[model samples]
Target: MNPPEPAHTPQPDVVAAMRGDLADWRQWLARVIVLAYAAAAGLSVVAFSKLCDLAQQGFASVLAFNPWTPLVWTSACTAGVVWLTRRFAPAAAGSGIPQVMATLDPAVPAEARRAFVSLRLSVMKAVLTAGSLLGGLASGREGPSVQIAAGVMQHARRWLPPHPGISEHGLLVAGGAAGIAAAFNAPLAGVMFAIEELASRLEQRSSGLIIAAIVLSGLMGVSFFGNATYFGTIEVPTLRYSMWWPALLLVLATGGLGGVFARLLHASITGQGDRLGRWRAAHPVAFAAACGLAAGAIGIASHGASFGSGYGYTRGLLQGHVDVPLLYVTLRVVATWLAVWSGVPGGIFAPCLAIGAGVGHDVAVLCGAQADASALIALGMAAFLAAVTQAPMTSFIIVMEMVGGHAMVLSLMAAALGASLVSRWIARPLYAALAQAIIARGRLAPAVAAPSR
Candidate 1:
């Protein structure tokens, strides 16, 4: 009682502990670790981008040698790449966004999650995706970039302390956001993608980490690629009230087609009660070779415009510098679907956008809105993406950032939302459905193996 009256002096150790709590070395270290991995992931993506460019250039050289080179070359190379994917990294196949989504899901077993985002799987994904492009497959790098970045950030979980504020889910989301930011050089779009596509909801604790990752990774991307939009800006005419009908028509058209494409892709990938899918599952390599040959034939018919990611073709169309055949959309869609159906490591983003551009160009010509074709092309790009992914916010934001089409923001929004709504009636949300399939497969594996044991 007397000691209490005299007021107990604070113990030095206790005071030091309080001070240490304020310092929070572990918390700081966790932040540092997250940031370091994010930068590394961004740089890795930049390197991958370079690899893909080289691959595309290499394929262009090959295609120039002979218009039919892809028939033999693409077939053989696709067979080899698919074999490698199946033999070494089955998880590396496809756009990989589904795998990332599955990893973030709690229902996916911990073992399956690790396998999905493992560094080894990521390396295979990059190499095989580059190989796919080198073989003249119609694929994009953006979706694979998301998975690669997530895998890189997944490694941080090992180094980080068990802190509530820093979760594996947050890291994966941050990594994916960083990937998009770095890939497109669009930080705001990355954030929107994180919230809209990657994470269902952005928690308060993870928001800072997500932003930091995007900033760090975005800086790295800017360092390597400069601060330019992915598609570069276009001189869009000031939109008028008369333009509304054309925009609506473009949205409906692209959204409907995009939905069909998504449905077909999902059915093929899941191998669900389809004869062609069953054949694909049974003879993956042979199926891939056939897809390559078919896609190659289509590319020859399109004068090689349907091969690779269709980036140059899409950009040229956007700039009104190139005129594709009326059948370009049909050729591109079939070729892209074939490539994706092959189960090789590739993405549909660029190819999908290319298809949309073709659709828009055709719609404008048919509707006698040629003057606003550029704007419609841009709208079609956004609309198709939104329709396919069912993520209108992410789609419009990404397209807006890629093209610097701020003047057409409202139009872009209307197109994106309208297309997404239209798509819903045609197909389920693509990535989410794919992710669920992945989770189902993962759960079945253990149970199926238990019977064997």
Candidate 2:
């Protein structure tokens, strides 16, 4: 009893102990904050889907009332959006993924945060992305979704009564994952993508928060979408033992091609940016207009095949309904790459998936073995995504969720790993290269320090 009393007397101040406990509690609370935001993000996806559906319906109605009416309106809207972006928020041009990466870069200055997250920039992104969709641009919603979600989270953080003491990088990563989860209705993939592709410095501790946020967001998304699969139910055919070798060959071919596409996109986008800066110094509007006109022409030629996220087209590819020839796939790849490269406010996520599916379809036909076409499409998706993004695990998870085929996990994993390895050997990571280009251009100030906790 005397020894116990002496031990108790030797303990540190009670207040200090309480303070330490309070700090730990605050950290836990902060992590919960990210998950809560993720839930909100999932809700946002459902909302966005509704908005898109309404927009499409409205356009159809307007077209019915007066044939060619919506196209005219869409053209005007596109031009207006281009003008707004050129005049007010040039940085909002293109996919905004690089912008998010720029913000998270430890080399960028904190003082420039306002410029990156400005209301004007956010508005411009919204308007342009909406206009692109209406005007039949070969773009996807995911990029604008990422930008808008990130802006929302950034502002939300500031609004907290006493802002959490976590770093902005954490919030940015969480926001991006939420955006992807909401956009694609694939929350696990979003979380894995953030960890594998976006995190400036990955760690086990940070990964836990990202995973929690992604799961919450995904659940929220399912609530809105009624748990429907994004790509519908794909009936994957069981692989015959003899088909394994051919499947491997398909994976290698697509992986190599995907790597080439990623490299080409990186070169064109950055090169065009540089050339436009010099050639169109006083005519940003003209540059944007040219991009819009090219997009419109491409849309008309492709007969809307390459437009939007290619969601319908992707489904068609998987179902073998599109009859998309290799040439069509090539054309789509080039058009989508150009649309994004020209600084249109859109995403490459859907387009890339479609490309991968198309490539897979072609490979399946080439194999001439009556393989499961849907399964081949799924493998193509994982392989091409891994090649482009260099995130094999994320790509694998995303295809699995999109197709809802856990049975094909082994095939997907093999394709993804093989593709990722081939792509890494062939080309640099896409986002990293994009980030470097942004920094080299001096469009963003260098990061001053890593965000502090």
Best by TM-score: 1
Model 1 misplaced regions, further than 4 Å: 1-22, 443-453
**lDDT of candidate 2 over 309-354, digit per residue (tens):** 6788888877767776436677778768756755557777778888
Distance from true location, Cα of 162 in model 2, Å: 5.8
Summarize candidate 1's per-residue lDDT along 166-238 as a digit string, tens digits: 8888988988888888887778878888888888787787688778887789789889888888778988987
lDDT of 2 at 404: 86
Off by over 4 Å in 2: 1-36, 54-79, 118-123, 160-165, 200-207, 272-282, 446-453
C-alpha TM-scores of all predictions: 0.93, 0.84
Worst 10 residues of 2 by lDDT: 444-453
Error of 2 at 188 (Å): 1.1
Q: Give the distance in Å from residue 380's predicted Cα in candidate 2 to where it truly belongs.
A: 1.2
